[model samples]
Every structure is written in C-alpha cells, then in structure tokens.
Target: MESTDLMKKINSFALRSFRDNADRDYIHARMAYRAQLYPQCFWSSLHALEKYAKCILILTRTERVRIKKNNFDDVGHEVLKSLKMLESSLNIILSQQTIDFLKRLENGARFRYLEVSWHSESAELTILDRAVWELRRYCNSGLYSYENSPEVKLLDNVKELLQDIENVTVENTHIAGGRLEAILKQPKSPARKELVWKNLYFSNSKRKTVWLESNFMAENSSLFLYPEIIDELTKYTRIPKEIVNAYKNG
Candidate 1:
C-alpha cells in the first residue's frame, strides 16, 4: 500500500502491457493515456487543478476538431455558452482550496497518478482487453492503419489479454478522422476566443490574461437562443420502433 510499492506495481503492469510490448514510444504514450483516463486525480498531482481544467476544456475540444487554425461562426455560439456553464459548474464543485490542491501540475507529466487496481496482474489483463476491443473495431473499419499508427500500439493491451476477440478491420468502421464531433476545436469558434480577444485584449492589456471585469460587448441580445430551445423541445424524443424491439429482445 506504500506509494513506492504502488508505483512499482503500476510499472510492472505497464511492462506487461500490450502497448509496451509493441514498442517503447507506445509504452510512454500508454502511460499518458492511463493518466488521462483518471485525470480527476492524476492531473491534480502534476499541475494546478484550475489550470488543468482550463487545459482539459481547451484541449479536449481542440482534439475533437483537429483545427489547424481557428473557426468562428453562428454554430460556435452554442459551444461557447456550454463552456461557460461547464467551467462554472466545475469550479463550484471543486472549491478554491481543492482546485489548488488538484491543479499543481499543468505544464508536464512529473507526478503520481492514482492506480487503477492494487493487483498489477489483473489490471494488466483488464487494460489489455479493452484496448484490443477498441482498436480492432477501428482497424476492421479501415479507420486505422497498424504499420503507421500509434493506434496499434495503443491496442497492445487488448491483443495480449483478449481471449476471443473478433478481428476488426478498417473496413468495418464508420468513423472517419477519429470521431464524428470534430468541428469544435478551433479558437475561432464563438465564445471566448473572439469575444475575449476583440473585447478584452486592448492596447494597454497583454495576452493570456483571463480578464473578467471589462467593457465587454455582447451581441445585440433578444430572444436569441430561446427559440432553439423551444424547437428542440417540440421534437419527439421517442426511439425508433426497430431499435426498440432489438433492445427488448436482448
């Protein structure tokens, strides 16, 4: 139960991991993956909790969209609003003290992460099987290539642990470019990027400053989003009849 012992166990689990088995870079990447999986605890140990939340909120959306530059538009408006709500909600839950404790490491990986399980042996097997299932599906669908992609190494755990995995090829997948929701990544998107930059950034101000109190100019406000809410509410929430039967039979 000692920290040293727990780390040793995690390392042992990694050594036996499918990812590490594939290659060394994979080994390192897998470590990062594990940390991200439980960032609630891992992030706090490395960087300040407040910074990590900002990083996660930013990076997650960025990765989702894979934006080289920025994209701002009417579609981006909703995303900005959602971010404000999400940020406020997170801060409200974590509190200032806990946020400080959690956010000690935002720059790089240089601290401890919470272990998945006490027994490295079991943890290895579990992690491996999940990787296999996830990657094989991507591979079968033609969304990934093993020879060139880090995705193959990521699935190392699955290849070792899965007993009877159905081989999935790239042809079997429907997702292209990683995932469906890819447009939300750019700083050009509505909310803070443009609003903050144009309104908040002034001749006297500097960049990277998150200024809250300013002569911020919001768009001419009316019943802007209220109509969309009404539109969604009027739409039927019922599932299709065929899918309903499939679920019932299962």
Candidate 2:
C-alpha cells in the first residue's frame, strides 16, 4: 500500500481507539457521579472532554498540522482552548453555557490533588452532558468511514444516559447525600439499567487492552519520538540542524 493509504489506516485505527478511550473515561465519570464521587467525576469528565476535543482535531486536520501553537500542545488540558482553536477551522461553535462549564471544569481539574476546596453547582453534570452530547454528535457524523471498526456500545448507550439525566438533578460536593442517595435508589430507566450492565462489560479487559495497545504504539513508535521536530518543521520549511542534532544526541 502507498504511504498515504497506510497513514489513513493508521489514523483511522488510532481515531477509533481514541474514541473508545474517551468513552471509557466518560463511562467512569458517569459512574462516579452516580456514586456521588464528585471529585473523581470531575477529573474523568475533564479527561473525556479533552480527548473528545483532540479527536475532533484529528478528524479534521492532518496529523502533522493539527494545531500550530506550542507544538500542538497549547490546548493541553484546556477544553475551552481546544474548542476555541477548532472554532474557525471546523466552523463549530459551542454555546456560551457549555463554554462556561468547560472553564469551570478546567478549574475543577485542579481539585484533583485536594490542594484547595472548590464548590460546584449541582447542575454541572447536566452541562457536561450537553458538551459530550454535542461533541459525540459531530464525531458520529461520518467524517470518515467506520464500517470496519468494531462497534463501541458506549457510544450508543451514552446518548440515552445523557437523555435520562437531562432532567434528573445531579448533585455536587457542596450539596451531597439525602436527595442524591434517593436519586440513585430510584427505579432505573431502561437506559440506566443497560448502562449499569454495559458499564461493567466496557470496563473490562477490552477497554484496557485498547488503551494499552494505543499507548504502547505511542511510546514505542518513532513517529511520536520527537514532537519538537514536528514543531520546528511546522514553523519552518527546514528543521535547523542543531535541533535535529540535539535530539539525535539527547
């Protein structure tokens, strides 16, 4: 096969793996929320959204030219920054409310280490639902053919999860217990029932295997060995020999 065809296959495989990983995080986030583990939920939600944003970048842009700033690392963990960077290129606009939630989620991510106390409104999960729903809608819009890819059940299950939670009140750290427990004990919708069942299935070896395989490739492949080289080449027609030499020696 030609190099272009090879890259396309590699990219397609990578994209599906990425989407699966993102769904893994998303599933765990929902589980955390249902269990009233707000902090874990926030962290997982942050990762899920960041990966979703990156997936959009991969889908729309070339591997070497995705984002120009900070060697395509400027978006980093900032969901809003990633969305803003994609706005012009993808012509996708997020509602101000979703944008605000992303900013809040960025701040919430810092609460991971318990260095500071933070208070988030109970409706934050609802906002997260909207953000993920929007991104997934775009992702499944057939930007590329996925006829050969294995079905990611979480993709379909999450749509119903989002719908079920659309009106249900999701509590936050500041206002925990009582109603939260009551909500969890309530009769589960068919969607929630399936979510609970499939969550366990998706959480099994299949999820870990896909992520580990993707990570193994990323770590072992020379293609990702020197992102700095990609950065220099992105900025200039030719890479400075010194930069190449430094990587060669370092």
Candidate models: Cα lDDT each = 0.27, 0.52
Tens-digit lDDT string for candidate 1 (1-250): 2254553443344223412232222222234334434333233222222222232233222222423223322222122222343342222122233333222223223212211111111132123222322322312112212343211222344333322333333233222332111212334543223222322111123433232222212222111223233334336553334333433443
TM-score, per-candidate, Cα-based:
0.17, 0.53
Name the best candidate (by TM-score): 2
Poorest lDDT segment (10 consecutive residues) of candidate 1: 113-122
Supply candidate 2's per-residue lDDT for 95. Answer: 68
Worst 10 residues of 2 by lDDT: 209-218
Give a tens-digit lDDT track for model 2, residues 21-122: 676677678776666677777788888888878776665453345456435555667777766666554545456777777887897564344323455455
User: Candidate 2: lDDT of 158?
Assistant: 38
Candidate 1 segments whose C-alpha is farther than 4 A from its true place: 1-24, 27-118, 121-123, 132-250
Model 1 lDDT, residue 89, Cα:
20
